[model samples]
Target: MNEVAILCVDDETVILESLQEQISRHFGEQFMYEAAESAEEALEIIEELNQEGVKIVVIVSDWLMPGMRGDELLVKVHQQFGDITTIMLTGQADEKAIERAKREANLYCCIHKPWRKEELLKIITTALESV
Candidate 1:
């Protein structure tokens, strides 16, 4: 997997845009950011990019979504792309979901809603470095 690629998935358009803007603003051209509004869309992007021979480094997803929750989507991602790091961003996540994600998806970390840009950037940088 390419280490400079980042994928972000969230159903909320505003949140997704904010993520893209914040990550870009903080890191500049250090990493490429790709965003999707849903798990289905994210999977399609993954497949398309994979066919183009590009590997993604990480996926930061929202925990609460319209269809597949972040944990479920991460699990599916882990199934197909085990080496890619995964993080969940959510305001409504519970202990059970965290436990499941940790075990099944090997989720690298969780970021709470309304995240601070610096803190979120640090978390992602750390996660990427460790992986």
Candidate 2:
């Protein structure tokens, strides 16, 4: 079977590392976890992974990225890959952006930064189950 992937996008290396560690610890080897430092890089990774026949089930992204914001990235992802689930993890995302994502991106959830590990895991687990 092609491995399913969970991609995390954040400019902060520490946040991405923490997310990868926590996700891997909870989900183990059932799915592959990937991270990107920028929205552009994440999009490239997604395209490459799709071309290689890997299924990306979920994306966790930061809202205030340097280039493309999280909502914009999620909207793009939804446009290209409608079935993939998206979660926004951000400290600075405005209400407008969140609402836009929810409407346009079919965003699964929006998590605030400094999120509890349990809450994050629960959201991902629930999303995966639904998927």
Residue runs of model 1 more than 4 Å from their true location after superposition: 1-3
Per-residue alpha-carbon lDDT of candidate 1 for residues 1-131, written as tens digits (9 for 90 to 100): 33357899999999999999988787787777899999889999888878877788889999888888999999999999998899899999998998899999998889999898888889888887887
lDDT of 1: 0.88
The TM-scores, one per candidate, come to: 0.93, 0.98
Q: What are the per-residue Cα lDDT tens digits for candidate 2 across 19-126?
A: 999998999888888999999999999999999889999999999999899999999999999999999999999999999999999999999989999999999999
Worst window of 10 by summed lDDT in candidate 1: 1-10
- Whole-model lDDT per candidate: 0.88, 0.96
Q: RMSD to the native, candidate 2?
A: 0.9
The TM-score between candidate 1 and the true structure equals 0.93
